[model samples]
Target: MRKWVFLCLLFLPFLSLAAEREIRIGLIDTFDQDFYLETFVPTIEHIQKTLKDYKITVIELQQHNLLANVVKERPDFLVSSAGNFVTLISKLGAQQIATVSRNHAYSPKEAVSSVFIVRNDRKDLQKITDLKGRVLSATEPHDFDGMLVGMGEIAARGFDPDTFFSKTLFSHYQYPDVATYVKVGAADVGILGTCQYEKLLTTGQIQPGEFRVLEAKNNTEACIRSTERYPDTVFYALDTAPIDEVKAVSLSLLSMPKGEFDFEWVPASGFLKVYDLMKSLKLGPYEHLRETTVKDFILSHQKELLLAALLLCAILVHVVRVNWLVNRRTEELKFALAVQRATERKARENRQKLDLLEKSRVISQMSSIFAHEVKQPITNLIYYASALSLLLQQLGVKDDRVEYALKQMNSQAKRTSDIVEHVRSYAKHKANRSEVFNLVEVIRRAINSINKEEIEGVQTTANLPQEAIAVGDSFEIELAVLNVLKNALKAAKNSLNPQTSVSVTAQKHMWKITITDNGPKISEEIFSALGRPTSTSKKDGLGVGLSIVLSIIENNGGHLTFRRIEPNGIAVDLFVKKKEE
Candidate 1:
């Protein structure tokens, strides 16, 4: 009985806390301070000291997920890291009331930055490109402000961090790891937080003279030290958040105690700049969501408008005069038919042009692959011919043996020549044509033609059925599938090692075949671009591969879609209707 009573007494504080009106404050996990004592507990302590009416709870989230969770939580207020706050204000309509300057390195005008560092002894490392194919070390992959921006600076200097870097080594342990990774030669280049590196050098944890900073211009934003300064945290409520609560919370944060923590509240920043950044960088989820929402709205309204117009025409036709109405109806029907035909014809022509453009884009992307593929066969031909010439120059060479050797060498050269021609022909044929052929067989032939021996950088596996057939231009389907396969292959190859493989699985159901890939995912921007001619990646692609694929599928009464895989990668589902039994 005594034990039960004690347990009930212990639960009283939790019950009272739960009963109070909840005010959520979002925090980022990047803040190294202990939340139990620093932000959350202190804030709650302040609330108890100041506001007697409400109960406030602090929720810590990563920088990337913080804004999204805030939108979901519909938080009354948010108190997050300075850098993350800037990101929110720039992208979302979040406002800032107070900025908490960490006493360690916080100042009125200085901000922290992750600087690029490399070993001083390494040769051939003057420019950014010198770090190509070298191991890059970062504290965390998703440390956007710390690592991403620093890398972006490198990319701005003409080296694409994603493709140019050979290996990425992530050490989430902080400055010590960054210094150690560089000192021990584990990483070719290391990114370190501004003060962290200085602290390490001061503490004798790392030798300052052992590392060199890449010569680049630097700037400051808010208090953050950045190569290219981005604004510090701003607090504001989003569209769905309650304004009164936000204002109240903002006021509360501004009135916070100075003894425990030194921070000030400021007005919320505009997202137009952030939107512009997103457009410029093509990073983040906002622009893609906006685009998807707009497209969906347009499509839905178009369908409704068409249906309503058709209904109005049918209902109003009975009120007009008989002969006059007949002539008017005839003209109207002709006009409608003509419009329909014109729309379809334009769509078809646009699709054809898109196809040709995609083929060229794919060819351009695979130039290195082509060069790599051609090198071996050409090298073999040269080596063998040189050996044959040397053999002929030897004394007492039999005529019959010489003839046989010549015949063999000629056959090998012709085979190599044929491989080159096949690759060239596939890339060169851009015109659209409609001729029925076995789609399954065409896929097999494409697989066979993949130059598996010469270009071993990509691994491709296709699970196509033996007897599946569809009546469409075989060449077009081959090209479309080839492009997708190549894309998947490249994505895998780029992100991972050269041994990465792309799996293509074809699922045949009642009148449909779905081709899927287990490769790096297609983002929303690329997925939403299906059948649209204007979408493209910056790799000089005309955004025509899927457009042409969609066109071909539509022509054959089929559909193409990009489905998101749960764990990773993307499934480029090409739904083609089966021929009649």
Candidate 2:
């Protein structure tokens, strides 16, 4: 009895492992099999612990054998680049579940970048164009960032690396090999990922400044990059995989504890950018297949070819006859059109002259009437205000209210005269003189022109670059700025705490000035009416301020747009072309 019990105990451990459910995962041979094993063992162990019944088995697949293995074995899941994921989804119906977020020194979790390097001592190799006729070393052709993206960068600069280089060598298994080749003078240039280069430096395999990063980019993330960034590796589930098991494994991977692996699985990031790269290179999902040629078509379908040729000849004859008939009809129509056009032109000229004379006569009469009618009202108001002021002085009127009323009367009379003068100037179509000037100076002058009382208690801020020079009528631009400022002030006054800010950004070809206000939201109806002539939402508004502003902006080759801000407010963007140096 004791011997039998010992035998049962000895076999129990093997029994447990044999009963454990197996979940196979396919991984691209980006790194060697040992590296993947070392990196993913912790993740697999974690998944097994979380779901005790299931154990993960990682299967390394070469690029050439990747699709074949997936089709033959049908692994439950996969780990590969975004480009490969797109290809698999299209070719094998695989679905992406998660993306690997590599925690490298210079790479972001969602994307990676490639760097082109040459020996630092090689001053002749200054740019991508300089790589022409030089020996180039790269990883496998299908390597996304390491090989393909670098080729795209060179191709964009009008150099085909394959033909341009005197010799091209590929390191099939490891990217580091390319760097080593370039370092030892075996190759003039090499391509590798930024992370891999940094790793080589940290490990003392490559010295600092041993290789120069060619065509270095000024990336905001401080990453050493040469080519445009692309999305990181993807973790996907096959269509044949069990949904429940896939979900369990996906959740486990996403929530897995972070340790020495330096990477974690996050939800899938978009792969359209990768898809675009694939299409541009004619690889992966966009791979160019063998197209049928004329010879092949004829050999395969002799009877169909004969029938097609006869039908084509018949169609050509029909087309030629139709074209000849069309030409004959077209000539007849042209003659009729010419005669009709001549008659219409004579009639239109006579009508236009008559209309112009009538308009001139009407305008002269209206101008005379307006001048006569408006002069009498102004003269009477001025006379009455002067008399009232004299009477108040002579009578020794001690009442402050009486004196104030006289003062207001005089002010109104002067305002009436200014309006009349302004109308006359507008009717005369006054020309605007344009000159190049700094926009910041114009904004300051406009702000100073506003009544201090109108902007009282409003917190205002301006963000302007040192120089935003533009060519336009300074007076007109200032007037537009004043009108926008006035509207923003009114909006600010309506809110609990009034705050307005102006931000200026200089773009490649234009300057963008944005004014934001914190106030009650403008209704859609009122917003839609803005920018139209004689449109306003204010109760006592003349509805001409924004109209004039719009006209001024449009006449000066600028654009203005209004947007409603969330939680209450408005933003106005003013775009103007920068002055050419």
Candidate 3:
């Protein structure tokens, strides 16, 4: 007894909870409200019998008051036709819990369909198309079985359901009214839901031979239908419904015996067919789409709009990327140009130094030539003066004017001789082969001379090989190398990142000294007349430095040549007779 009491206590709260649970179910009042209780009371009683402790409330939903009542009454579940269920599911977040199958006559999904009815004697209605332009009796277009099914068939045949019939009597689309109207000749043709004809015959309200189904379609149903079948009615829940209680209600409805009622609950079937029907007719959930608006336009042209947006984004990205690349390249080009200008400036400075060197060399050459020539002439004059003085003394023909003239001539000749000697001493270098020195050391001297000017920003590189002995005057070699280096540096300075390079490579019979520069290419005229006095790049140049350098090198058993460097530069090669070890 104590154990029994404990068990009861444990179960007591659940029973009380069940008793306190109040459920409200909304029913779409598509049927006549007068017969609403008779039509739905059995189903409600079946539910009440299952949940004996729970209180269930019923709410009738008129078509005009569907959304408003659903919001105000807040029903836990909804029972309605498939079309009304679709509307509620879309607008109120309702989900199908079970489908209604009438008397186990058809599957839940393919339960109801429409049929065309005509009198037996109406031979004129041999086919559905024959009824075109004839009178049609049906409910509103929204009625799934009464009208939409048959209209859907007409539409499937590519006929406009609205215009296929010349005239139509529209109403609530009650099946019996359609049948009676057809029988009485009030309507030439009629539309009915699946199995309504059999029902009418069972009630003896119509004779079998009195009517004939037009174009009956063979399907897996107990009733003859002229159109494809769609799901019948559905039981669904709103967002506010308790899932556990809703499931209990579903189980109860499914378990309801196929008693006196025309319908029973079954497992939920696919409602997509109904949605398709609505789409074909442009009714129900698709009704708003008939109006023209931006939202509707977007919904209709969703793919096109999405593709256009993507293409636009791609173009924007491509443009942005291209612009960024162009900016980067422009900046790079600017930097490169600035560097080039700077290098060219430095080159000009070096060329100025070379020009100065050329001027000094030419002036020294002229002075040496003048001194050599005048030295002999002045000595001859002095000798002549001495001879005249001696002859006058011997002949005893002495005069004060002649003596003064001789003295002046002698003094002037001596003074001129001294000036010539000074110039000759300054211009000449007495280099002999006995002074055997390293050719590399001679190049070092030439570089040292160039460094005296402290030239900046000109890169000079020299490759010195092992003991490149050359049989020549070191001084002349040094001078020649120095001249070549100056020329290279001058040319190289005209470029960005100026480079002047000297390389010495020794052979068995000769040693090669090559100097290269990265500068403007040598002109053909300048190259052809190289090592000769010709037109030079300098405004005041007589091309004397390189000429003197060539002369000196030839005098020392060596020769030099100038050639162009590929791309933009010049190179000089000096082949000196090597003093072999």
Top of the candidates by lDDT: 3
Q: In candidate 2, what are the lDDT values of residues 1-581, reduced to their tens digit? A: 99999999999998876654678888777753434665556666777789877767778777886778777766888877777888888887878776666655343333777888999989999988888888988877777768877876776676654577798788875554888889778999988864667777889989997889988888665367888887777778888888878889888888876677767767755577777777666678777632348788789999988999999999999999999999999999999999999999999978866865565455545655686579679978989988988887898877788778878888768756755554454446555566898998888887887898988989999887787898887766777787898889889999989998877898776777888888897777788767754345679875656755776677777888888886689888877668987
Over 4 Å off in model 1, which ranges? 1-20, 33-48, 62-74, 81-93, 101-110, 127-129, 174-176, 216-226, 234-241, 260-263, 268-281, 285-581
Which runs of model 2 end up more than 4 angstroms from their true locations? 1-20, 32-38, 105-110, 158-164, 173-176, 220-222, 289-581
Error of 3 at 75 (Å): 1.4
Tens digit of per-residue lDDT, candidate 1, span 8-32: 9999998886665566665555543
lDDT score, candidate 2: 0.76
TM, every model: 0.40, 0.46, 0.45
> What's the true lDDT of residue 2 in model 1?
100
What local distance difference test score does each model get? 0.60, 0.76, 0.79
Please report the TM-score between candidate 1 and the true structure: 0.40
Q: By TM-score, rank the candidates, best first.
A: 2, 3, 1
**Model 2 TM-score relative to the real fold:** 0.46
The full ranking of all candidates by lDDT, starting with the best, is 3, 2, 1
* The candidate that achieves the highest TM-score relative to the unseen native structure: 2
